[model samples]
Target: MHFLQHLPHFIGLERLDASEIRLTQSVITTLCGLPALRELCLYMPSALARSEGRPFPNVHRLELLDGFPFPTTHDIVAFCNKFPNLRALASSAGYGGLLRDLTRAEESSIFPVLQEYTGTLRNLHIFARRSTLTHITLVDGFLFSRLVAELQGVAALPNITFLSLALITSESSWFDGAQIETLFTLFPNLTELQLTFMPTEPDPQILTWQINGSLDALLSLLPSTLRSISLKLDLSDYHDTRDPDLEDDFSLLFDYPHFPSLRAELMAKCPALTYILFDGYHFLFLWWKTSTSSVWEATADYYADARGPSGAT
Candidate 1:
């Protein structure tokens, strides 16, 4: 950590990637002294919950790769308050309950920490993963609702342009078309979006399933400014059921046979969209725009040529 003392002299250092190292008070303090440091990635230490350190006024981007101490909301609020100019933040959802608190209808006091970056904050990445079914049920919907509420509460972030949310859970209803629409409404300027939903079966009652809606109806709700989009939906559970009507609906809505047509439809509707990706059960569809073409060209000459042709299995 002593080497960090010399970092201030390298005044030109604008980005620091310390994801592989454990951060300590001494190390963090040393790095914060760097006058030109604008971007930093490191783990937040439990000690930070008690430390009264100087603010990183110049940092515009900060990524916390690990969970903070217990009561993560307080720690996250402290860090957000410390970095007044942060434009981008990436962290695990387990460590940032501040989002949930902000959306609470009973908490009337404004969050000064988040208010500090309202004008400059533009990107947010939140990732949540839980292997146990009990734990998943305890936090998945609650966290997601809080996220939505937080976004609804913050009306000052008009410049926000990128958002990514990845979750591993057993709840299929955690995010639906309505929720996606709500997200678009919250961040109207978003140009890029990525969503990965990995569903696990914890009990017979809880299985991954698709939301009821046509792809066109969902895609139409996206902002016109969107230039890139990546979506992964786990629909493998749809085939496990014995009901014929349910299977028919699932096959008609999201089966691989309809992807090429969906691709063409999406490109025509969203002229600014240059990239689209869909990865799921028996489906790996990708499309990108090329020069001299207003339409999206499929990655493979034919969908079947890309991989051995197969139906929803």
Candidate 2:
């Protein structure tokens, strides 16, 4: 028992995954014994502040796992202080639900040097105004009004090179695809992109999205620096429903008759785009070249994939 308690002091522990450990004061004291520790993963790390100890100076990468509620404003400050040199923050669970109460100074200082973040769009919107982040992945999906309205005083971040996010398909908002174009403009240097779609309502009798116009107006604005694009539909909410595949329709947008020509034209205009993928509905599109010119091609995975999208279920 004693050896187990003093185990950290004997070895040169450089990385730790304490996410499953019930972190206690003794556990924290054990952490202080490792000076070479540079990477860490923790779960619901609110107790770090209460344990009086010198901070880890070299820790730069932090991965926060979700089991309990997120650290509150009370613990957020001191918890972040433990890793003053942190540069990347990742969380599988959505982030920044209760952290909206932080003061301007605290918000600015939180992840002050962060260059990469993977979490919810809500938190990104909360911190984007003050962040210089170069890579972002928002799993919770984009909320347009919530992102732009709060950034009235902030300029678009050009340093970002990679971005992946999900957007809910709401006919009223996403019909023209203007929102996505605006998003591309925010990160001018973005090289790789992936966009997933989700239904706005959880279990509607029949879910449908009929874009009123062609998506070309938005595709025309694809960043010249962008090299790849991916679009997906998440039907996880319909796993147990009756006729799930046929009921949740997104036809007018994805199965537009002219999309093949549109893609060829768009790729010609952008020149830098090497791949355009439609991952949802089992559809796939590729960019290839002919003897004299370049063109776009479509590949399918199954019989359903080859069929055109349905306007409505």
Candidate 3:
């Protein structure tokens, strides 16, 4: 990492792909010295000390490969304080503690980092491992509601244009139709969104979500600014046993018979949406903007080419 010092003109630095490289305070200080550094990616280990009183004035993008052991809210606050101009922030959860920290934060003491970028930050992404949610208590719907509340707090992100969150576990609660609507309300200016949901147990009764309305109600909740969206649903854990004959059957794995109608409704309700990707039952439904007659046609063709006639393996 010392070589970075010689390249003072460097505008971007990414060492996340290097799993062996552990970032420490001194290395961070070295990177901060770069006069033009605008982006940085690093793998931060737990308990790593942070430098004080130095801000990355030019940096607008920051990505942390591993969730830093933010020992306290002050640590996260201090880190955000250092990147005053940050426009995008991405973090991976080493455990579920990060989510707990964000959700449990008192309303009076919201995430200071997000508050810092309330006007400038345009993109936010959080990916958590399944083990992270294991410690949380699963009640009627407390855990899911808490998670949603944490996201809702981000309504302060009035200028945010993109958001992605992938936190899946067998015990995690599903986001029913109402929760989905609340999500769009929280990020009203979002131009793109991506989400993944997966449950752990094999209880057929518990795995499937019971949305109150048709898919149109869910799709209509999207903000007018949204141009693209991706939803990945993993229901493999719902089955008690795997049948060899149906192992390769995609349609039998998950049920969404109204998918075609949903696509049509989406096009009608959200004309700005140029693309939609829905993957369920191990089947993929993709749509892209083109000169084609219908967006659904494009999605069907893409699905057919990718999955073949059976559409599942």
Model number with the top lDDT = 2
List model 1 lDDT by residue over 222-266, tens digit each: 777778888765545555564435444433453343666776676
Clashing pairs in 1: none
Put down candidate 3 lDDT per residue, 1-313, tens digits, no spaces: 6653444445454322324566456656666666667666656534233575367766666666654466765665556557656555544443334324443333223222331121111112221111111111111112345555544434434455665554344434456566677666655667777666654553433443432232445666777677777776555544335544432443444354365687677767667888787765445677667445343332332235574233221
TM-score of 1: 0.60
Model 3: per-residue Cα lDDT at residue 71: 74
Using TM-score as the measure, name the better of candidate 1 and candidate 3.
Answer: 3
lDDT of 2 by residue, 1-313 (tens): 4544775875577778877676677767767667777788988677676668777677888888886654556666777777777778888765455666677777776777777888866577555654467888876765566556645555677888888877666645552456666676677778888777675653332232332142455566678777777766676666547445543344322442245676676677667777676655434444544445455465565436664432221
Query: Candidate 2, clashing residue pairs?
Result: none
Candidate 2: TM-score? 0.76
Give TM per candidate.
0.60, 0.76, 0.61
Q: What do the candidate models score in CA lDDT, each in turn?
A: 0.53, 0.65, 0.50
TM-score: which candidate is best? Answer: 2
Backbone clash numbers for all candidates listed: 0, 0, 4
Model 1, position 263, has a per-residue lDDT of 67
